[model samples]
Target: MITEKCVRDSFAEQAGYCKILGSSFMSDLLTGLGKQLDKSTETGRRVLQWSGDPAHKADALALRLAGALHALARSGQDQALAKFYHNPELSSDAEFIPAVLSAIAANDDELYQWLEFAPQTNEVARASIIYSGLSVIAKRFGLPLSLYEMGCSGGLNLQCAQFGYQFKGVEFGDNASILQLSPDWSGELPPDANVEILSRQGCDLNPLSVMDADDAAKLVAYLWPDQPLRIARVEAAIAIAKNDPPKLEKADAAAWVEDRFQADGAKGNVRVLYDTIAWNYFPDPVKDRIDQHMHEVGSAANADNPIAWLTFEFDEEDKGPFLKLRTWPGGGQAEILASADPHVNKIHWLQEN
Candidate 1:
């Protein structure tokens, strides 16, 4: 059974993560809520009396509430609540928690409804790091890719090949594209390789469509208010996706991979399976199934139909996220290519071109 103290501790812990990710606004906001959230309001009651595991790795309870507050703010339903998002004076030590408490009371029903769903950021800039990995694969194999993404959310990154990228000094994709992801770089730059994505498909339990106005708006709202760049890039990506949306299906991660492997596609293209900060969301059983199934299918991967597993995920030991890759014919060999914060904004290249 989850204790009330445990849930409240998760709020503070998540706030620390927000701070580390360069969102002091989110950090302070979450801190204020964690310190003061009580059973006076329906939302507070539901949050405190939650039955499920509320850790970031489990239910992500803190992020759910944070996303909920952001959604309510974007709706323009509460003026006082919106001020706490970015206003320095309003978010000061004395006034911040009061503003948070007031908002929870005023928007009790909406916030409570939001807790039923998980948060989906669909961060667009992280694609730059994924593109760097793609660049390495392209240069190494000199082949087109059949990309499959797990926990795809809006499938915005599925259109990664369409977005502009700059890894260190090396550039890829259309320079004039509305969405440009140029993360801070170091070490040898990724080689300027011709990366072609022959096919793209992704799976998510609760997939959002960029073409859907409501979904699009919801995605934008989840972005931290202090980071307008994320908001702008998402808007651009959403606009681009509307022109030619990638294939996204609602399915379990394990089931989707099994189905995709069973339904063979065009030969000779490198089959890449990738995800960003999404692995922790999979339940232990689901994780095992996906891993076991991948190993089974990966055993058959050959030079002509190679398979690559790419990931951008947190490493508690490293105190930050790392970009890692494993490709069969040598599936057992794993390579860490780069390191970056959760958003992949300021990154250090780890591999030589």
Candidate 2:
């Protein structure tokens, strides 16, 4: 977990205005601004414009504007920022932050609705890395999976394999027909295997019902502020949901995992996995409980009835995502598969001893 001291240190590295505000001050200010911007009243604009420094004022205004767009996107308001985006004068002035807000605001739909604005606390890149790692493990385990994702905001990464992947000299998916491919990779790719996903289920603390168009827009806005691919992915997921919405449940991860594991049909040659980012959000006790349950179930697993865990998570010492692969019925320590950037689509296989 990133410590408060680390957070403070990060704030200390900021320049000029941000530096002056300090971490605590900035935290309060952001929270206050987020609340105030939702009102969309004169007071909001006045507060937004009150920063003393010119740069700070611009930053504050941008933040306020982004926050409002974020709220609109979260609430599923369709194209709420369209007018703002189309206004030629504000286009360049809005910068990347506003551009993201404007794009999301324009894409209000069921699939888009699942996207939620996560604070910086949410580690998207890490999550992507974990997904990539798990994909590799899935291949190695030679298991046909029925994936169940927790906190599956927008289900973008869920489509990782379906989407074209290109990294290093290797390539996967149908890429030549689509966009140019470029991803970072530094190890051997996972062994080729016929992998099939029988089903995909997801749970979230707050599931986006998409009953409200406004909520869909808000989801798009919550996506990373600058990744257009992410926007496209969310849009695609939305389309998928329109045809067949993912089976989603509003529930706690620990309880959900316990119940699922306890249920008779949950066992298969299926590989149960979670990756880099989501695990951190789980409280320690929840994590412990999940781990214990996995271990108990794993103890009974075998080659014919195999259960495996594939995780791509932070390697604090290496400052990158590390892949850990473990199997059950011969319960033991997990093997380190590889370590690399989590967002890179390609997987690098490490030699197992």
Candidate with the greatest lDDT versus the true structure: 1
Cα lDDT for residue 154, candidate 2: 45
Candidate 1 lands at a TM-score of 0.84
TM-scores, all models, native as reference: 0.84, 0.64
Q: For model 1, which pairs clash?
A: none
Error of 1 at 254 (Å): 2.0
Report the Cα lDDT for residue 254, model 2: 83
Local error of candidate 2 at residue 283 (angstroms): 1.0
Total backbone collisions for each predicted model: 0, 17
Model 1 misplaced regions, further than 4 Å: 1-13, 35-40, 55-58, 86-89, 93-102, 262-264, 314-320, 329-332
Q: Which tens-of-lDDT digit does each residue in 57-172 have in candidate 1?
A: 78989888888888777777888777766463355567767877888888888789889887778988889889889988888778999889999999999988889877665678
Model 2 lDDT on a 0 to 1 scale: 0.50
Instruction: Give a tens-digit lDDT track for model 2, residues 107-214.
Output: 434223222222221223333344445565566566677666666654434544454555566665545423234456666665545556667676667666443454
Single out the weakest 10-residue window by summed lDDT for candidate 2: 113-122
> lDDT, candidate 2, residue 177?
24
